[model samples]
Target: MAKNNTRVRWVSIGLTALIIIAGIITAFLQAQADIEAVNTKADAIVKTSEVMKIEGCLPSRANGNNITRIDTRLDSMQREQRTAFKEILRRLPNE
Candidate 1:
């Protein structure tokens, strides 16, 4: 009878330990998922802000000044790109 009691006690202790470990693992995974969700929301907010900035920079029909500024900016960007392409072509080896 004493041997049986000892075996029962050890089995209960093992089951309790297993339950505690499982709870800890579940909590850790939940925390990780929460962190990922927050990061995803942050990324979405950043992307939204970037799109808003671009929209603000673009010209609207009601704003003639913005249209002129955007056209000037586009012209400068095209010139810079053309210059960079010419430089790249100059650097290539003749085949």
Candidate 2:
């Protein structure tokens, strides 16, 4: 009976030790996963910053030229409209 008790105690101790080791391993793995997540986020932020730098805030040359062309065309249209209105006013009989 004593021998059986001794064996049972050893088995319980072994099981407790295994449980503690598993808990420690689980904690270590969790910490590693958290670190990897942070690294991945940092990498993504760096990539985004690089993209922003390449794209820039201001319009490209082609876009700027197009905007200038549009503005000139609008000014020409406005001048034509003013001339047409002046001609119409000259044709109208004075009261």
Best prediction by TM-score: 1
Worst 10 residues of 2 by lDDT: 57-66
Best by lDDT: 1
Residue 72: error of model 2 in Å?
Answer: 26
Clashing pairs in 2: none
In the range 36-59, model 2's lDDT, one tens digit per residue, is: 999999999999999987777445
lDDT of 1 by residue, 1-95 (tens): 99999999999999999999999999999999999999999999999999988887665645755667878999999999999999999999989
RMSD of each: 5.9, 13.1
Off by over 4 Å in 1: 59-95
What is the TM-score of candidate 2? 0.56
Give the range where candidate 1 is weakest over 10 consecutive residues by summed lDDT.
Answer: 57-66
